[model samples]
Target: MADDFADVYARLRTIMLEAAPAMTINRDEAGALELRMPGIDPKTKQPGWFGTVTTKKSYVAFHLMPLYTAPDLADDISPALAKRKQGKTCFNFKNVDNVLFEELSALARRCAAT
Candidate 1:
């Protein structure tokens, strides 16, 4: 793990928490962090996994599960951020700056809203 990774994780984690206060936080023993909105079992009323964040050795991955349910929101992501996407819903970043943070902040709000 890089020395600066903690800062990167903190910034991304803050955005998730600030944008989605209702989500449940699950701290992985390995040190990764996740903010999830449970999916009600409907019949059982049990909470299921919704979305999350997992910090890897090289980059911090933001998993917006809502994207799978509502793909339209992907349109809001900038071309800049789109380039950083590794998969359908994961956006990975090794370093962050003001521009990325602003774009991500908007994305977080939109993700939480959706």
Candidate 2:
């Protein structure tokens, strides 16, 4: 991971934990950090959310999967996600901004609550 990506991930992890203490943050088999709330299922659940922060060759990417496949989410995040060149539900943040981080944290909290 790039240094900036690591920094952003650390900041995001802190923000997320602060907002939703019940959620768990861990590394997946690919070494990407997976943020998940216990008891939430991506399938058979109304709101199943998960996210990963990754560092690719050119940029740092944040991929968020919103629960329930809501078009509202795509509509809401389309501007920020305009840079994506691959994947179904991915958002690329060239630089992590307060607004984006806060929105992500809010989403995490909302998903955890459901």
Candidate 3:
């Protein structure tokens, strides 16, 4: 079955919104998408931690951040997730698991709080 990144992103956005109804999500200028939660202090406001599932002609890439704003988080997840494609990181699954989705939502919430 062929996979579409835009559809995947929309599903993820829906899941995130269901998890945190107050959160806002939209695509950025670079065509990358972003999510933000309400009530975040303006001074501390920052883009929510995000994951990307990019589709290439050959394969799909699942770029997840186990932690954001801290390099160690990416480092920790990278080793376990490391499989390269054209010198880039990729994930085998077409769809992410429920646990990962929940974790991503949690990370977004945490980032919004700060």
Candidate 4:
């Protein structure tokens, strides 16, 4: 495993945890952390996904589920951080970029609150 992936995952995981400290932790293991909204979700009848940090082969992925339902939460994202976005709500990083990570942290907080 690349040290970059480990470091990136660690920081991203911290951002997720700090952003949604009250969210249910669906999984927390060596390379993945999943945070979910407490209580059963109306749509899935399972805990709603708040976010996740996973170590991928080439990068660590931070997924914020709220961004899918509330796109406006990302309106203030910096271009540098926006470039890391992989899809509707996933950000991929190979290394820790403090500037972008801080931006992501803010975004994650909004996502958690939303």
Which pairs, if any, clash in model 3?
none
lDDT (tens digit, per residue) of candidate 3 on 55-110: 44544444433233443433434332433312222243345556555554554344
Candidate 1 vs candidate 3, TM-score winner: 1
lDDT of each: 0.74, 0.57, 0.43, 0.89
Tens digit of per-residue lDDT, candidate 1, span 31-72: 376765655747667564455666788888877777776778
lDDT of 3 at 76: 37
Question: Which candidate achieves the best lDDT against the true structure?
Answer: 4
TM-score of each: 0.83, 0.59, 0.39, 0.95
lDDT of 3: 0.43
In model 3, which runs have C-alpha deviations exceeding 4 angstroms?
1-7, 16-32, 36-93
Q: Mind giving the per-residue lDDT tens digits that candidate 4 earns over 1-114?
A: 467688888888899999998899989998999988986889889988888999888888899999998989999898888899988999999988998998899898888776
At residue 41, what lDDT does model 4 achieve? Answer: 85
Quote the positional error of residue 13 for candidate 3 in Å: 2.0
Off by over 4 Å in 4: none
